[model samples]
Target: MKKHNYSAGPCILPQEVFEKSAEAILNFNNSGLSILEISHRSKDFVAVMDEARALALDLLGLTGKGYQALFLAGGASLEFLMVPYNLMKENGKAAYLDSGTWASAAIKEAKFFGETVVVASSKEQNYNHVPKGYEVPADANYFHCTSNNTIFGTQMKEFPNLDMPIVCDMSSDIFSRVLDFSKFDIIYAGAQKNMGPAGTTLVVIKEEILGKNGKTIPSMLDYAKHIKAESMYNTPPVFPVYASLLTLQWLKKLGGIPAIEKINNAKATLLYTEIDRNPLFKGAAAVEDRSNMNATFLLNDEAHTPIFDALWKEAGISGLPGHRSVGGYRASMYNALPIESVQVLVDVMKDLEKKVSKTRL
Candidate 1:
């Protein structure tokens, strides 16, 4: 049976990437040494690092733009603290927009370092929509936001144009769509979603923003240290990084973000349309702020959940359960997920409606 993967993080990656990564595990680059056994500093591995960084910058259109891409060990969770540790000064304030769980976590970490102000929050509405019309203080060190909220399935449709530096946690949605990368002073993502496997984090930072904070940052958390060492400050996550590199290569071969965006949109549209039209289901988020990456919905009647669950499971669907924070269904459509899988989910939804309606009659 063919399986459709909708798992959130540590999520779906290109099958090609999986195959290549598996090959490297046995014999990397015909070197007779597994990627796991190879030294990160070896010339061959260095070349891999160089190419990966170059590809990331190229795809983001930040090549030759004074931005440095670093692949580090900590996931986005560590970055929650690292962001303010390096950017927020002893007295400086940072503005945050709370859209979901991840964004709130970021705000919590920033507060430990300095004044972290939440300019706007959708928590009052259960984070169902992106907060709008909030002012980013000119005096704040930077404006931080989570571009896509995985748990609540909401996304920031538009970014605020602020004079201060802009930082984003793009863990779940990076490389899924095209964005003006230059607008952000820093962008960080975990490798598990839309990139590759877990164990690595990607950080792209404008070089000038570092070294401004008054408090001393730990070497590992310091962006400048990572950039200076070319992301070899400590031994990196070799396996995950190699897999991510392969995924980036696949993305490039598929015509970069512009081409991928169209496919992602189509997949989201197919699933969302069914959610709206299906009599048994309802969307959890505001339509305007719905995330293209994570689509959250719930069944109208709790009694019918088992029927729907059995239907999709029988159809060979995996990872359809939503987060415990928000009980329902979450369909995470990452870059490599094909539109066919989405259609399968949609068809199952329609099938459930048919079965339920006939039973009622």
Candidate 2:
């Protein structure tokens, strides 16, 4: 049976990337040495690291002047604390936008390091929408936000233009669209989602923003330490970093972010359109606030879930079940997901519609 992957994180990757990456794992660049066995300090591996960082900057349209890209070990979750640790001072407080689970977690971590002021939050509405019209503190260290919430399927449609440095967690939708990197002081994402396999996190930071906090930070949690060491302060996640490099190569070949954004939009539109039009299903998020990456929806009759699940399984569709927190179906349409996969899902929904009509008659 043909399989369509819709798993959220550590999600589906390009077949070509998997194929090439697999070959490298066995023997990288025909060196007769597996990529896993090579020394990270080796000249060959150094080139891989350099290319990966370069591709990230290139795809994000970040010129070398102010931005420095680093591939680190801990995921963006670590960055939650690191952002405040490096940016927030002894008396400094940071502003955070609480949109969903990840945003709240970030806020929690920031509080451990320093005072964190929640500038806006959608928790009152169960994170169904993005909070709007909140005042950002002028004296805050930096303002942090999650660009897209994977579980809730809501996105910050518009970013606030603020005088303070902007920090964003783009873990779920980093390269899924075109972004102005200059507007952000720092941006970080776990490689598992749109980038590559897990075990590595990508960070793009403004060079001038580091070392401002007088409080000493653990070397591992310090961005300046990772930057000076070129992300080799300690042993890095070589395999995941290499896989991310391949994904970046794939992204570049597909005409960079501009081309990928169109395809992403088309895929999301296909699934969301099906959900909106189908009587059996309804979208979970507000129309304007819907995420282009993770599309969350629910069955009209909750009891019909099992039937819907069985039908999709028979049709070779998988991983459409929503998160427990949301309790429905979530189809994660990341950049690597082909349009045809989404069409297959739409077809499944249409089939279910037919089945329901027949039973009613």
lDDT for predicted candidate 1 compared with the true structure: 0.93
lDDT of 1 by residue, 1-361 (tens): 9999999988888889989999999999899999999999998799889999999999999999989999998799999988998889888899999999999999998888878899999998889999999998899999999999999999888998989899999999999888999999999999999888999999999999889877788898888888989999999999888999999999999999999999999999999999998888999999999999999999988999888899999999999899998999999999988999999999999999899889989
**What are the per-residue Cα lDDT tens digits for candidate 2 across 1-361?**
8788888998999999999999998999999999999999999899999899988998998966678899998788989888998899898989999999999999999998777899888898888888989999999989999999999999888899999889999999999988776899999999998999999999999989888778898988888888899888998899999999999999999999999999999998899999999999999999999999999999999878878899888888778888998989999999988999899899989999998899899
Worst 10 residues of 2 by lDDT: 59-68
TM-score of model 1 (CA atoms) = 0.99
Misplaced by over 4 Å in model 1 are none
Q: Give per-residue lDDT, candidate 1, residue 341.
A: 94
Candidate 2 — which pairs collide? none
Q: Each candidate: how many clashes?
A: 0, 0
Each model's C-alpha lDDT?
0.93, 0.91
